[model samples]
Target: MLRRMFAPEGPTFRELAVQALSSVEHGYDLLAPKFDHTPFRTPESVLAPVSRALRELGPFGSGLDLCCGTGAGMDVLRQVCRERVTGVDISAGMLAVGRARETVPARAPRMEWVRADARALPFGPVFDLVVSFGAFGHFLPGERPGLFAQVRSVLRPGGRFAFPIAAPSRPGSAAYWMLAGFDAVMRVRNALWHPPFVMYYRPFRLSDVRAELARAGFAVRLHALPELGRRPDGSPRCRLVVATRAEAV
Candidate 1:
């Protein structure tokens, strides 16, 4: 089932190569048609558990899907948030495709699709929750502070910003080598290319990320999504970072 979804009508090798060579925003625009069919789209397995956790945490009012590609995360927000849901991304093509998604029911939260960079979100303190999935890799480590601050700024005080972070694959493992090689190739590509298409696999560390979030004025906590199961070391394979904006003193 997983193999079939990612295999059918998804981007071809040549198409993926073209996208890799293109600028980040333009690459997504090119891939928007078949994005949902690609493994790049966050799967239902992860979404289901994330939504369940958010449900237990919430009844949140307004929600934002930061960098929502084809609105997969928006569906989760619809189920958990009551007032309104917004999906914002830099790619207009992605937003257009997401607008046509049938995942959200008419009775669900009212929805908005906005085209904007995540680093420079065009919203004030209006959202009670902001969630992002699988989109952080595009930003360099230096960019995380400003990006987190932007999410913090858009969220109302006491609101939450949530996303999943998977446990690192053990060193010398196949997954580790694959990710390391990918990042190495990307580094070479960016050094030679004009506008870098900056998707990286290994740069986001939980400790560094927590520090950045704290610097952005968020009180951070990690909720283990046990449905994803645990690592051999007994730690969770994936944990949701639930960072809340501090209430006024």
Candidate 2:
């Protein structure tokens, strides 16, 4: 099923190989056109539930889609924000595709795109809400503190940085082993290659991430996305992490 979809509309194996060997920014630029067709794009199953969750929390003034990719996450913002919305990413090619694909209706919140690394966002502390989807695997564990701080810096006091995170697959399960193998391969690839493509399947554990968010000056909370269903243990399969910036002193 997935193979048929990729072969027809997605990037060829050679294209993906070339991308994997390139720098993250360059690789995404190359992948921009066909990104939506690829599994790398956040699936609608995830996005729809996220949208429903955010809707309950918002009617926000302005929003930013951090590392927006092809702007699929922007649909969530459009539904919940009453003012302007912006999508920021490092790759010019990805930004271009997002801008072209997301056309605003006359009454919709205004849309804008900016090309900037998430590490150094080019904006004031203005946004009321900021959301990211499926972009965290790029950041190493050590880099998360700075990344969270950067996110905090761009948000107004009490503004929320929301993103959905799935529960880790149980240890020794097939999903666990698969993710473990993928991360191991990424480690090897980064060691052997120049301009490392930093996409790993593991390493962003919820416990560690919650601690980092607290240290980064956020009041972190979790909202279970019941729409995505529950695990066999009765815990949520996915939860939305809503990290609110501390109000001004």
Candidate 3:
């Protein structure tokens, strides 16, 4: 599995074991070479639904791909934004791989990659849309307000921050047990390690996320991405959280 998805230079078992014990950014840097191949990368299924939703709501002027790993979100931005698209990520290694990907043609929206922490973006309120995929679990709950504020700060009034959130697994299901075991292993790792990788599948509840977005001054809405199908309970299997920043004073 590792050989199929990860390049030879990609982290070895020992390297990954060490990286799992590091901070989130460093762990990603270590994993970047093989990231897209891993199950961790956001699937094309989710991306297609999100792109369709944004197309319905957009024609956005400029877009930002937050924590863009390997430029998947930037590709979505290219399809939606008319003016320009920028990808910002903290991992130089990841950004390098992203940059190595064939650039979108000049006839398309201009593309640029910036290396920076999401919590401290350097751009002004210049983006009409901001989208992220599969990177939120890296942030601790306490860090969410500040992170949302950062996203808000970079977006123009009425611009949006959008990302997909899948429904949590029902208790006693195989998926639930797998995630539970993973979380337990992570907790033990963090307890015994130095810089901990902050990823928890369950803790990033949608309710808490909506509240945090509101606290950051965004008007939050959840759009069902029907292409992903529905849960047994009939709730959307996946949703796009559209957090629009209120118009400035």
Candidate 3 lDDT at 227 equals: 100
Who is ahead in TM-score, 1 or 2?
2
Superposed model 2: Cα runs more than 4 Å off? none
Model 2: per-residue Cα lDDT over 1-249, one tens digit each = 368446678998889889999999999999999998888888889999889988988889999999999998898899999998999999999999998898788799999999999988899999999999999999888889999989999899999999999999999999899889988888899899999999974888899999999989999899999989999999999999999999641
Model 3 Cα lDDT, one tens digit per residue, 1-249 = 446545564556776787787788888888887777776777788899999999999989999999998888988999999999999999998899899984667689888899999999999999999999988888888898999999999999899999999888889999899989989999998899877778886798998999889889999899999999998778998999999999752
Question: What is the descending lDDT order?
Answer: 1, 2, 3
Candidate 2 clashes between residue pairs 3 or more apart in a chain or in different chains: none
The positional error of residue 209 in candidate 2, measured at the CA in angstroms, is 0.7
Which should have the higher lDDT, number 1 or number 3?
A: 1
Q: Report lDDT per candidate.
A: 0.92, 0.91, 0.88
Worst 10 residues of 3 by lDDT: 1-10
Decreasing TM-score order of the candidates: 2, 1, 3
Which ranges in model 3 have alpha carbons more than 4 Å from their true place? 1-12
Q: What is the lDDT of residue 133 in candidate 3?
A: 95
